[model samples]
Target: MTSAIRPPAAVLLPGTGSDEVFVRAVFGGPLAALGLPLTTPKPLPGAAVVDGFLAELDRLADQYGTLLVGGISFGAHLAAEWAVANPGRCAGLLAALPAWNGEPGPAPAALAATLTADLVAEKGVDAAIAQAEAGSPPWLAAELSRAWRGHGDGLAAGLRVAARRPAPELALLRGLDVPAGIGACTDDPIHPAAVARAWAGALPRGEYGETTLAAMGTDPESLGRATVLAYLRALTAEPVREGPLEGI
Candidate 1:
């Protein structure tokens, strides 16, 4: 009898103010289809979200050896930075909706996150959700409604930290040799497609794909499938090197 080969393990982090539930919903189906079991850890409030995520990354690496790491928006930035720092450890990188590059500035996503955090802090979660729903598209409104409510005050704090977090430097990106997939949304303003294109362009082994928040809201699998399939294609073209893998 032939034995089944185990797929490499993947850990996906959620966007700012998002939780494991949200990440799982976004990635579970596509990852499972690709034979990867997804682990989405819930980050605690206070302390930079990136810091918490990095700690989780270390923990997961300890457990799994090499890992396939990825995330959405700010989470993507964290994953890319980690991958850059520990090039030999990552099996692959899936950076979805990467918001910006280089040092943090007045990026729209950051502004929105900060603004939303302020709103939540002053007006309260329910009021913030109402305002967001009123201003955003139906799909985004629904997503924020759920994620914001779930996060509560923590969401606000996370946004503040994410706003100040720096993006992976070009030097770091150029150093990454692992297979990478960048998922972008052409219409997204908060997470601009240009940034994704730049990231894909920068990485030596990066591939790019596109999916919309609307699609994700309706069929969460679309986000994962588009991104993972692109990464899988890159992996198939050039497999990961064999070595004693380290932690990221």
Candidate 2:
């Protein structure tokens, strides 16, 4: 009897202003169940965050050799960019809540990040959190409040940096040889599902999956399970052409 091949270890990065705790909550259990140990790194401050994450990825790659890498929202964009730059060094990619592709422009996620930064800068964290909580869903409000508070004054600078950073170009995405799973939230304006669909369509080996931010908020494990399942399916299938695919 043959033993199963173990999947590569996975490293999951959190969204902007979020810490490792949040990512662990969302991805830890499901990935662990799949026999893949998960690593969630706490982000750095300001313009250093992306650079810091890439450096961490490099360190992990040197240690593990072509491991699975993934992230949520802005973190997802960073992961994609790194994967594109370091081809053959990624076992697979799990992009959850991809905010935009290529140039940042007027993408809702960037705009919202900028606006939230301004609010935090002008009105202070407490006031900003109160206003954001009043307008946001309970889950989002809670997450933001904690993240914002944890980030403190540095949150504004980090948000500004994230707002301006470019996403991985579609042409680059089209060149990826590794399997990819894109997890999208159907009703999330800041992290539009259409962006995720476009990403799946662009990748040479990609599959798409849908779950709402609300659903993820209620059950963080849902995002992890959806993405892992989609990635597993993509690994078994032929490299998909650029087009719409049935959601996972």
Candidate 3:
């Protein structure tokens, strides 16, 4: 934790249909415990959601000399995308619940988001939220209820944006060349743990940990700790010999 290596702050993003409130609930205490400041950007409304989140990360990187960026699900994908594009600006990465590696295609989270978007367009936010809540975990249902309402008229557009956005490619991830810690909810059907594991395995210097949505519902910090601990592990792991990770 030398001053030279420690980042000034962590910029965390929330997932589709989620907001800064949830990000705070999950990462606030854990980041605070690390004596690290946390910035949870509010998701932008409408079709430009993905671009807007990436812009927010860019802004934070400019504000601080180096950034430790992270997010949940869709948010995690965006964070990694930015890291891949701006490896020099990234100090490290702390990603949780990555939904997919590249073009979303038929990924469960992407499909769910797209379906919810279409539902919102047809039935309105209230009805769409009700339908989405039907079979979801109570905590998840309650979260969508609150967050979807917060998005209001723009909810559908935002959902569509996330559903269609492409994540960083595996080649881009392999070239990111930054310490990364990935976390996953092993039981999360929408955001599979295997996705997180793949992301961790792709990076030249990365580590991963797992928790469950059930545990996350009871203790939001469970996800945060899993992510941050993995980050610490990646950070402290012996440095790999200097070279391009092109073929790693």
Q: Which candidate leads in lDDT?
A: 3
Judge candidate 2 against the unseen true structure and give its global Cα lDDT, from 0 to 1. Answer: 0.85
Worst 10 residues of 1 by lDDT: 239-248
Better model by lDDT, 1 or 2? 2
Better of 2 and 3 by lDDT: 3
Give each model's clash number.
Answer: 0, 0, 0
Cα lDDT tens digits for candidate 1, 139-186: 778787887777766777888888878899777798898888888878
Q: What digit string (tens of lDDT, one per residue) describes model 3 on residues 93-207?
A: 9899999988999999999999989989999999987886898888888988999999999999998889988998877899988889899998999998998999999998889
- Residue by residue across 1-248, what tens digits does model 2's lDDT show? 99987668798898888878888887787677667888888888766888899999999989888879999999899999989988878999998889999999999999988998898889888988999899999987898889888888788888999999999989999998888988887978889899999998898888887777778778877777667666766887854432333221
Candidate 1 — number of clashing residue pairs? 0
Residue ranges of candidate 3 with Cα displaced over 4 Å = 1-6, 238-248
What shift in Å separates residue 102 of candidate 2 from its native position after superposition? 0.4
Q: For each candidate, give its TM-score against the true structure.
A: 0.89, 0.92, 0.92
Taken over the whole model, the C-alpha lDDT of each candidate is 0.81, 0.85, 0.86
- The ten-residue window of minimal lDDT in model 2 covers 239-248
